[model samples]
Structures are given as structure tokens and as C-alpha cells.
Target: MSTDGVGFGVPWQVSAFQLPAEAPGAAELVTRIRELRARILFDGGRRPDFRDGEDYVDDQELDFGAWHFVGRREADGPPVGYVRLSTPQTGRLFQSRAFLGEGPFEDLLTEEGLGTAETFEHSRLVVEHRARKLGLGVHLNAMAIAAARCLGAKAMIGTSGTADGQDLFHERFGFRPVPGTRRYVERYTEDVVLMLYRAARGAGEYTALVEQLEPVFSTITVTPERALGDLPRAHGRAGSSAVTIPAPGADRRMDAEVWRPVLFEPQRAEDRGELDALLASGQVREVCDTIEEQLRELVRSREPGRKLAGAELERAVGEQLAGVDPASYGVWAWYPWSGRLVHLLPREEFRLVRTDRNRGRIERPQQRELMARRVGVIGLSVGSSAALTFAMEGIGGAFKLADFDDLSLSNLNRLRAGVHHMGLNKCVISARQMLEIDPWLDIEIYPAGLTDENMPEFFSGGHGPIDLLVEECDTPYVKIAAREHARRLGIPVVMDANDRGLLDVERFDLEPERPLLHGILGETTSADLLDLTFDQIVDLILTMVDRERISPELAASIPQIGKTLSSWPQLASGVALGGALTAEAARRILLGQPRPSGRFYTDLELLTRADRSTVA
Candidate 1:
């Protein structure tokens, strides 16, 4: 019933990684594993004919076409244990075939009627001495099985030494001897046994073990397929159509896992052509340079009066950027709409502009609480601004965005986008802006917009339920329609009028039976509001928005629809101000602060009054 930060049911906090040989920390990982193995395997007098170094036996050649998983405690610590899963069709299970005599492992598999195509090999499950007693051995084996399952392996074959009771350990963990493969060994003066554990695709003797490992599987999964924009899981043995390359403009989206490696991969390959061309155009350099400059400013603010020489700053920032692996972050996201990369990794100790300033104001724990909140935004005109602000402050764990409208030229005055995004969907544009700020923030797009047919599903908790709903739609029907779902799900609803900064907070979570919109429209159903005339709709909106307290300009401009103005007046200033106010309110409400159901005004007229105090 207990869980760690990542929801893994382990004795100690552990980070499970499946990294390639060329991954950022792969070299250090390889060295650590080798050292640990040497300390344990050769701690005695010496192993017989061990060709590897006196300290460790590192089959570095085996690293090719193999995935390595290293387990570390408390993140940022030395690897406590390591395992390797290799999906090979031709190669024998490392020196095991010779011991069993003339491909005996494969013959044994054939005799068992299990094909070798869907089979893989797991080996080198070594754990450090200090870390061994904490149930890491069992965890490492469980995670190795998880990795095997993730890679679509139906079974695994390996050889274990009998000297340290490893063979007994493997047998205890569902690994059975290959009937006649147990034999005395000359390799290390220790007996060895070839073992087999069948994952069996969907059903196997180890079905219960697989079922029990569900939680660990979900936690330690390395979703390379989903991470690489829309890359399909590659199948087939070795060379028979085992790879697929994304086409042009297809690599626009990049999640945290895929973004870093995809970016660092050289541009000469045609498979990486989209990014190759972009990098050649000098975009990446320009972007990283701008980010580095901001990081410098952060350093200045963090330690006032401290400065670095121009050359020294460049070298320091350059090294830091090189180490900025987006895949190393806790949260990551991909936004195809705006074509940007986002991750939560800190470089130069500067995450965002408010790093030092927000330390005392918001505090790390408070920000973490805010980040754990799941928010849904239903309208992009104002909701887009709110989403962007929330992302800038890292205030949402995930987001569900719904807006059916496309970005037209007229929307540029209020929406935070340039002319390049003119024809894109409003939700997509908002998502892009949010992702550009923090790509690791999870986002779901309702491209066709929210409807009654899909609203229930939208509010459902698959990843997690919508914690709070921000309703900013102008359509009278949707405004009430969204609240109906919010009320049913007990989700708090926040909306910004973007005029006089009227932020409406409906604490449906606090008052579950509270009437939709506090019954202000007198049970105004969506169907009933749909039949009203445009003038009636205007009157309904004004009544709901409290026209009595609206800004002088907004009040004057509301009634002049079609006569003086083309539509209800909306200003860039008002929209931006509404975004800032709504974000602040949402953070408080999500944190369970005392923001009860009410309409609060951030009226500029009242705040910047002529009789205001002259304090600078």
C-alpha cells in the first residue's frame, strides 16, 4: 500500500534506466557495472581463465544491439545494480552453447517447441554488496523481465554460475535448467547451468510472475516507440524489415525520451533528415544561445554582484548545455502543433526566469504541489493564455485542452502566437506555446473541441482525472455544458471573462450539489440557451458577467454589437491580465487554499486609482 515518488513499490527509491551505448551517461554506467562485477566475482583468489580485466569482465562487444538497464537509488547516485537484455536470433546465449554442446540451447528450445525469433537473453545481473540486501536482486530480475516484455520478447535464455548459489537463485525466480545442461565448469572452477524462462508472449508458465510485475513494468518502462513522435514499434528478426524511418515534417514532435538522443544523433543520416535540415539552418544553436543567456541572468540574480568573464561564461554554459539531456528529466512532453522541445531538466541551476525570485514567494514544495495538479482548459481565447502562464510557472502535472476554433488573423491581438500559426487550431497553438515553455508538462488536445459525447471521457481518470476545469468559452451553450460535467466529476471550475479581469471560481469540489453557475442563469440548459437570438445571447452574457461592474470601455462596447463594433470588445491587455489573474487563482484553488466559490475582480480602475499612494 506504500509507494515512492514515482509510485514504484520498492524498498528504496530507485531509478530504472534502459539506455543505449551512446546515451549521455552510458560510459559512466558501463564503468560502474564493470567495477561492481569485478569486486564481487574476483573478490576470492581468482576466477579460472577469466579473460576480462583482473577487476571486471565487461563484454563490451555484447553492448552492441543490446539494451542495458542500470538501477540507481535516490537518482543521481552510483548504479547499485545492472542487467542486460539482448534480443538475438542467431547468436548463442553467450558461451552457453559450447558448454551444452553444438547449439544445445537452441535444440533444447526447438524440443520445447519455442521458436528462437521471439526469444532474447538476459545476463550480467550484478548488484553491489551494500545494495544487495535491500531486495534489489529480486527487483533487478523483475525489471529485466519487464524490459524483455517491453521489447516484445516471448522468452529469455541465460547461463548462471553455481558457485555463489546463482543457479539456485535463478531457479527460484522461475528459471528452469534446460533438462541436461547443468555441468561442472572450467571457466571459474564453479559449476554452471543453462536456464530458460519463457515469457510466452501473452501466456506462459511465468504468467503469474508477469502479472505480479505490472506495477514495476509501468514504472520502469522505456517507451521508445511513443517517445519518438509517432514511431511504430519495430518488429521482425534482425534485417527482415526491422526498422522504419519517419518522413519529412514528421519529426516535428519530440517527447523527453526521444528528443535528446534524436537531437544529438548526427544529421548526416536520411532518417534524421527533418532535424538534420533544421540543425543545418542554425536554429538549434540560436535557441540554445538564447537559453544560455537567460541562464547567465539567473546566475547573476542567484548570487548578486557575482559575475563571470565572457570566455569563462561561454565555456561553462557550453559544458552545461552539453550535459542537458532532456531524457534525464522526471517529466517530458511532445507538442506537434508548434514544433518545440520541452523538458524539466535543470541546466546551470536555472530552470526558468523566476528561479531565485520565486524561492521564497512560491517555495519548492508549493510549486511541486501545484505541478501535481491536473487542469483542463475548455477555451483558448483566454484559456490559451492561462495554459501558457501555468506552464511558465510549472503549475500543472498535465493538461486537457479543448478548443474547436482555428487561429485567424484577428486572434493575434489576444492569442500568444505569431502570423505563422494563423491556420492552426487554437488548442494546438496554445499547446505549442505551453510546450515551448515546458515540454515535459503532459498535454492532451481535444482538437474537435469538447462535446457532450466526449466530455465524459475527457473528465475520466485514465492517466488521472481532471482536478480542476478552466471554462473560458464564449458560447453560452458550452459554458453551461462544461459545468455540467465538472459538477458531475466534482471538479472545480475557473473562468476568466478577460474583461475587467473578472475571474469566476466555482468550487464544485467543495459544493458538489451547488447549482451550475450557482443557478445564476436560473437553470439555463444548453438547449434552452441555443434557441436565443444574438441580442438575447449578448444580454445573457452581460448578466452572467455582471455588466454593472464591467470596465467603462467594455460596457460601452458590449451594446454596440453590429452597429459600432463588429463583435463584443476584447483587448490584448485585458486578455493578458486575465491570464495572469486566472493562473494565480487556479494555483491557490488547486492547492486547497481558501478561494471559495465567488467572482473576484482585478479591476485596473480600482487598483490604479488617481488617489493611489505614491510609493515606488
Candidate 2:
């Protein structure tokens, strides 16, 4: 059962055993194969009438004359693929006899002048889903066919499931569907076709395979493992999904695991192979082809007055890229969460073209200074928009996002997300959106949300301390705690109430002694805020934002909290404005502008008042 073999130049250990085999390890191997069949065919494939079980076996599997062929990637590896070959020597008839009835089954054999002794049936082919793209199915099929030929059989027969192109795969090996034998099987819940392969009309890949294995058919050791090097190589790569398939019960919330994107530089030879294989894996849903577009912008940024149009712009881009190999020109950024491979200009050039539109408003020196800063954001609801806005404006080259709550249907009113993102952590959703905007951004997410343990790391991790903090969470303790840390670390903080368009900026970097929330909560610490009643916390937030100036709509909605309304009222318009306001204030503060610690308002309702007069 430990026979070493070669299949199409891939080293594989092939094993074969008759039912009721008493050899050592034979029973265990059979059990493993049965379990794989049950899980893949019965459970995952949704075959009917099969209860969840550890193993699957039909009456045909118990026949002493039936033989099983199993293939494994390693000598000691568990079986990854299997196929069964049954002959007439078994006392029981073929499984297909029941489907076609004895009359039609025997009549078809007689019409072809085939005798029972010279014919065999192959069925029960199964391959692991992860290994399907690696040509394991073809190898297993070749093993079954080679063994059947070695056993002196002149013809092969099998009932192939027509679902998922299984019958078509068999056709490549010279199996022809027996006329009028295609019918649906209740157990499989799919149409099945009886296929036949005769020795006299030898054809297809199976014929070449049997001939290739003829020399090693009698020998057990398949030496120089590349024995089947003459065979055509299989197409496609295995396990190529951009999003890695997690192991059973694995925790997917680890921020470092799923949220970060990997960059592949073409300079390394090994990375080139890896990138080529990745592209061939079919896992990347979208490969951003904006390299030339960005290149055109790069040229425009250097020569702003040059008017290159149509083919002229193309020629300029071509001239710039003339000496560079297309594959090695720019780096590729792969985002696993979204399965997007983005081709971008080298880091410096990418930022230059990205922030080109802000040339006049944000001078080159100011923009460069802003891009060097790091920002930490807590509470991803409104914070999601703020983080994305910061990215688009090139306000920060690195960001630390924190959010313990998931995106819910109710939060969709103001948050920038779709229904598919409902169950995802807000930090993850925010990081993904920010990365999509600028793949070169250094982003770290706290899916568990902001906590005492991670608060320090959020402010200052391996990438160095953040220059600015944006406090946006509803939790009173976190709000106070984040500000306390910011004051101690000399990091500036900004917040948008999403009501009355109130944008709160605290220049802790300049005034570390500034009382929390402008002394609204005098002598209050995060610990004190933690134990306050829900209403007390709400009052604290209201007082900090100036309760008297609260918007009319929000003032009315406050009494409805926990009674008629589930939460405070917020509109998309307010959230959008909050992002814009925060981004503007952050830019000025990071660049050492004279924006002081205070709460400013741009309330649209008041600003766009119907009857407004100039105040002298």
C-alpha cells in the first residue's frame, strides 16, 4: 500500500488494495478514503439521503473483487485523491446495473461484443477541493486506468456524474457516453451518464498514460521521480484564492493576519516566480491597470505647464518607461481581504501624483510634511469616513484604526459601507477602504476596539508614535482615556460630534496641561467615567459639546433615546461634513498652523438659513 509512484512528473505515492484487505495499514487507509468521500461527496456536495457520518461506503465497496486506487502527495501523507476499479470477478453485479436495469446493461455490452471477463468499471473518483487545480484528478484517473490495463482488461466502463463537468473530464480520457443511458440519480441529485472505453479503439490521454506507465507497471519503486516528464503539464495553480482559506475553527480576527496587504517587489527572482504563480491562480478579482494613468500624472506633476494630449501623453509615458521592464517597473500591492492586486508607482512617485490636485491649497512642503505624520482613530462608524478622507488628502502615511463594534444595519445611515459589510468589524472595513485608496499606506487595525491594554500601542507602536489622534467612539471611558493618553504623549486630538457639525480640536502637543474636554469634566479620569450611569455619560458628552448649542433635531431626539429611538439621530450629510471638517483641521494642526484647541461649528441648518442678515 506504500507504493511510490510518479504521475505526470509530480512525485506521488500510489496505493491499491482489494476490499477486505488484511495487509497492515490497509484498513486505516480505506477508512481515511471513506471519510474524505463522505465529507466531500455526501456532505459538501449535497448528495441526498446521506446522514452526517464519519465515513461513506456503498455495497460496491464491500466486494472482494473491487480494488481501490489512492494517491498522496507524500509517502506518509493522508490520501488526497481516490478512484475505485471494479471487475466482473466480483460475485455482485456492477453498481450501474441497478440504474440501467440488467436487461439494458447486458444488451449494451452484447452490442459491443464485450465479454464480462474483459471489461471493468471505474467509479467513485474523488479529489480534495484544495488540490483539484493541481491535476490530482487526472493522476488518479491515470492510475486507475493503468492498473485496469495491467490486469489484462480490454474495456473500461463507469457511471460518471454529469454535474460539474465530471463526464467531460472523463471524455478527455477516451470515455464515450453509452447512448440512452443518461439519467438522474436521486442519491447524487444530478444526472449521471454511463461511459465506455474500449481497448481496440485506443485513444485519448489515457492511452498515452498507460503506455508511459508500462515500464514501471510491474515495479513498485518509481525511480528518478520525473518519469512522466514527457506528459503534458497540467494547467492552473493550486490554492490561488486571494483570500486564504482559513483552517477549521481558526480565529480570523487577528489584525495582523487578515487586514494587512503584502507587497511583491519584482527585484527578487523568487518574488517574480511567486507573483507569476499568484497571477495564474485566478484568485485576484481585479488587477488595477492604472499604472500608465498614474505614470501620465507623474509626468504632468513634474511639468505642470506641458499640454500633452491623446497619443502625445501616451508617447511621454512611453518615453519615461522606455528602459524599464514592464513587470519590474512598479511594485504590486496585494490586499488579501479584497483580493485586489494593485499596480502602483513606486511609493514616492505614487504620493506625488495622488496629491497633485492639492498643489495650490497644500503646497509641496506642507503636503510632504502632512504625509510624514501618523494618525490614530478610535470608533470606526464616523471614524471610517474620517480615515478614508485623511487617506485621500494624504494627511498621513501611516494610520492606527480601533473599533470593537461590528458594522450593523442601523449604522449604515451615516457610515460608508454596504450590506455585505454588515457583520465585519468596523476597524477592518475602515482599513480595507483606506488601503484601496492608497496601498502604500501603513495601516494597523484593532478589531477588538480601543482598550486600556492596546491604548499605548495604538498611540505608539513599532512604527513610532502617532502625531495626531481622532477620538470618535461613543464610549465615555474610551473618549476620556484616549484624550488622557494623547495629552501625556503630546499628540493632538480631533473629534467630530456629527451633530451641529461640531468639530473638536485639542492641541495636546502644544498644551499638555489642557484639562480633558476643556475642564467640562473637572478632575474626571477615564476610571471615573467608566463607572458612571448611562444617562450621566450622555450628559457628560452633551456638556462637553456645549448642550445649549445642540442642533434642534438632535435636541428633540435626545429624550427619545432608549424609548422611541434606539440611538442618537445622525444624517449622512452631517457625517460627510464631519469628515471634511476633521480632515481640514487635522491638516492645519499637523503642519503647525495656528488652529487652537476649541470647538468650531459649520451647522448647515444655520449656515443655510432662509432668512439670514449680516451681523455688524
Best candidate per lDDT, number?
Answer: 2
**Which digits, one per residue and each the tens of the lDDT, describe model 1 over residues 178-292?**
7666665544444577888876543233345445665565475442221112211212111111011122222222111111112222222432443344434322323232444
lDDT of 2 by residue, 1-616 (tens): 2332323233666666565555555454455555555445653324524323323444334444477766676665555677888877851467776678888888878998988888888888976543443456766787778777888888998899864457877888888999888866767755688999976665485677656755554553232122211221112212112222212222233222455465666766745765776676566778886877788888888887888778888788888887786657778887655667888888788888888899889988998898888998898888878998999999999898888888889999989999877777888788878877887777766666777756766777534579999889998989999999999999999999998889998888899899988888889888887678879877988887888999778788888899999888888888889899899999989988889999898978787786764653
Please identify model 1 stretches exceeding 4 Å from their true place.
1-356
Error of 1 at 422 (Å): 1.3
lDDT score, candidate 2, position 391: 94
User: Against the true structure, whose TM-score is highest?
Assistant: 2
- Model 1 clashing residue pairs (backbone): 38-55, 332-440, 342-439
